[model samples]
Target chain A: MAGKTPAGSARSDAVRNRRLLLDAAAEAFAEGGVEVSIGEIAQRAGVGKGTVFRHFVSKDELLAAIMLGMLDELIDTASGLTTADDPGAALKGFLTAGVQIFVRDRAFCEVIGRPSLQHAEVRAAIDRLCDVAEQLTARARDRGLVRPGITGTDVALLMAGVQQTAAPLLAAEPQAWRRYLDLVFDGITASTGRELPYPPPSHLSLA
Target chain B: MAGKTPAGSARSDAVRNRRLLLDAAAEAFAEGGVEVSIGEIAQRAGVGKGTVFRHFVSKDELLAAIMLGMLDELIDTASGLTTADDPGAALKGFLTAGVQIFVRDRAFCEVIGRPSLQHAEVRAAIDRLCDVAEQLTARARDRGLVRPGITGTDVALLMAGVQQTAAPLLAAEPQAWRRYLDLVFDGITASTGRELPYPPPSHLSLA
Candidate 1:
């Protein structure tokens, strides 16, 4: 492996640079806004502006990449949770992960929060997240941990609730989301036996 | 009244046109987005473009007016609740009104949903809303209807959660917010007795 050709190392270097740029961009956008310059992002990544453009043609594309990357990471996390010994804990953990992401990526939250402004990539990511959520929630229900009559849409609503409600208070209380999530978990867990109001929310049908 | 002078009728006509333009702009903005053209809005209002220009100097001002109008309506609604016989019911009704507003006014929802984008008018509205929410929640708490230890911020989070989660589903099912609101209502009500997770949310400082 040490004797690998220059091209192979160059390719690996490119991958590392791209990841760095995405991380840098995410931070810059979250800290400032979408208006952060590409050159600034490249500077943060310790790469040339040409290298940044080489990875993502435009800032919008860079934003899309970050969103897709977050969704892919979420999907990976959700898939891995299937093996967890406690389905209930896995479900709770999934929601907590979502809240953390919302807190971490204000840019991503801004995009997902508005329907009028969402691009195709954002919708795709939400659909994929919804699928993963449905799977884990089903497992929790099967284990008698999650309350009956709760749907994937309800789970989506709960995670979104935590995100939107907690994001603003992060400066004053970083862990505000945790408390809200617990109240939500208690409400939805089987122990509560709480019946949701009639005529459930619009089915988040990905079909 | 029928014998009113010509000048009096002309003044009434100006007032009517202003109301028409505002209502039309609100509908157009909510239906399409904040980008809806003034000419298009005037067309919807059955008025000329000059009428719109006469009422609003620019689109930014128009948006501000709409936001202030919403806040004024919300403050009015909240104030009216003090007359209700049941404080708990009044508090719940206030939240329900919020959901209905979010469902009815997409432009308003977009404005209120993002803390970063909010201007002075929106912040003032939220501050007033928080005050009203505290008053109603305190009354409800005294009546043993609202659960213990819930603050105005908690109530705000719950309402924001419902509005954010339910806004997207309005197209598929208009009453979708009602279901989620009920779930939230249950969680916060005395019947649940559900202890919130440790380290509660940031204190919503009204002082």
Candidate 2:
């Protein structure tokens, strides 16, 4: 393929190399952490050092790309998740799957949490995630899967909450996060099958 | 008092100044943001610039102290809140109070969210928070206020999520966060005054 000069071949090779670098970079960054070097990513990808820099201008860009890839995966799954029979079930599945992604891919999730990425391009990528959330949330509510009062902003907050919920999954107990997700889902989700465990009038309405 | 014991008086004054500086530092960082200067904080607190340095060696230290103070307030409130009729109700109150603190005192909340402090003291404070949440969750379950299957880690994540939810409160729509909070509470709290709002499930169980 490299020997041939087809019109789309170079772009395809570049795309393929970009994916390789992103996957390798994510693994290296997760294994060695955020401070891991570019050369390490290159070595892991089995690509030339120049190729890594060629695909990404700097370490920050590379890390950002790796993160963008994960975010894309997350958003894509969210988009696909809306097609389920029950919107509530789909939303819960989306939340659980996203949590699993964060637990499985720590460095990628840190793209949003890390202070270093407060820079422009990374901020844009992170900011764009809100739209993804907004759309998914709208779809869920429109389908009657979400609580009636749950607006786009509300779902976004819950999404952030879910990420926070995933932290413990990596720590002392992995299963603990699942329980957390259940609590959260129960809070927002109306009781259909499970007896509503929480009684009414418990919390003083701040309103 | 000052005339009776000069040394004791001076020490007490120093303590008062330190508290003032800490408060000033928290406000400055929250209002203007993380990059605000030490001199500015000293000026805000009506202290000499040197006194700011005397109290905290670095901005990071000041931020950490501010976080410690905020966490202290939260823990105290959470402790007091557990006395509600149902422990589950107490947990909800504490969570609401925590949200109010983070929203009302963003600078301190931002200070706690800082990555720098996550290493030592901050991590312990978070662990202690989890402990409080764990006990609260367990007690709520025993009292049957918590929807069954809820866990401490979920509540912890929910607290962090609520804080993040409150961050854009000032710049966004008025009471947008309040709506978010309402929807979130709907999910976390048990149904009251009305029937569960969703379709009935084929199988249901709650202890």
Candidate 3:
């Protein structure tokens, strides 16, 4: 029993330290981008450099983990909205939550085209996110709210587009993304009977 | 007469070399981004390293020159479109030309937020571009083609948004941007009578 107590305490400490590193790293990266050094992240975590290495094998691994966390949160948000009473509003709610993540986390946006996306876990999570987006979009389409031929992939791409469009002014006008989002939302939902010029992207693969 | 001929020949050679350097540098930066070395640009231009240094003191200067050229071309395109038969088509034409440049030049997009934008010439050129965009947009607004309060800056930002949204898939789907452009164009022109969520940005200063 005495031996087990020490082992259990050590395991809990590892878990706590891991959480601290992730939170600190996320904040540092969000503020400074992925270029924020692991050393800086350790200092921010109030832990030794060796501790960061123990948890994340490399900077890319740490980034992949962070991206996974973000994707999962988005997935959960989309999943929750799938059965909401208003299909259009549900999709908008999901997009608002997703773009909010990009708005707050500069590193997440910077890392989208980086090699970390090639990580298997990150790829799987993105695929899952697309799945949920499709479900939400389909719900709206069925209600005749979204335009015909609009796909979840199109919605997903447009969400990222909204962030990109508002990125330049995010510092000066943090709520600027809302404007672009509304424009894109109106674009998808206006039911003008005009077809999108291109076929929907069949899949979501940023890697 | 003999001395004048020699000097005239030297001046013409310099002019030709400058043109060559600009073309080579533009192509290199478009393909490899701003990280392409001056030596590589000189090599592509078939000029010596000293020739590149003589024409442009630094890489940023070289990049500024390329950007100015691009901006001037866009300005010309926009200027010519102000009197086009259709106001909406003119704005869309301007956006199409602008986005096509972004699609072709990776460095132009990369340098938008970089220090080079702080260069006085680049800043002036961007302001000029915004002015022309304003002219086209105001024409559309007066004709009730564009939604109320949709400023040229809004149109400008959305053009960039379309590029950013399609950037990730550009390699596999070169024309994907056209689809996003159509979506955004539809957004600005739909006239569904919905007010944009936020006021338009007043000016363009990527610096």
- Answer with 1 or 3, whichever has the higher DockQ: 3
List model 3 lDDT by residue over A96-192, tens digit each: 9988888888787766543334577877777788789999999999989988888887787777678878776766777889999998888888767
Ranking by DockQ: 3, 1, 2
Model 3, span B1-207: residue lDDT tens: 101122334578887888899899999999887779999999999999999877777778888888888889999999999999999899999999999998889788766543334467877877788888999999999999888888887877777678877776776677888888888888887778778778776574344
lDDT of 2 by residue, B1-207 (tens): 111223434688887887788678877876665567887998999999988777676666677666666777777777776666778678877777777666666465444443333435655666676667767777887876655545555565566555554443334433444544544555665653333232221110100
Per-model TM values vs. the true structure: 0.79, 0.64, 0.88
Whole-model Cα lDDT of every candidate shown, in order: 0.72, 0.59, 0.80
Give the TM-score of candidate 3 (chain A).
0.90
Q: Write the per-residue lDDT of candidate 1 for residues A1-207, one digit (tens) a residue.
A: 111133334677887886798789888877655557888888998999988877776677787767777778977898898779998899988888877887777676666655544557767777877777888889999878877777766776677777666656666676777877776676677354557666655344321
Chain A of candidate 1 compared with the true chain A, TM-score: 0.79
DockQ of each: 0.39, 0.16, 0.47
Interface RMSD of 1: 2.8
Could you tell which candidate, 1 or 2, scores higher by TM-score? 1
Off by over 4 Å in 3: A1-16, A47-51, A113-117, A204-207, B1-17, B37-52, B113-117, B204-207
On TM-score, the stronger of 2 and 3 is 3
Candidate achieving higher lDDT, 1 or 3:
3
TM-score of chain B, per candidate?
A: 0.80, 0.74, 0.90
| Full ranking by lDDT | 3, 1, 2
Task: Point out the worst 10-residue segment of candidate 2 chain A by lDDT.
Answer: A198-207
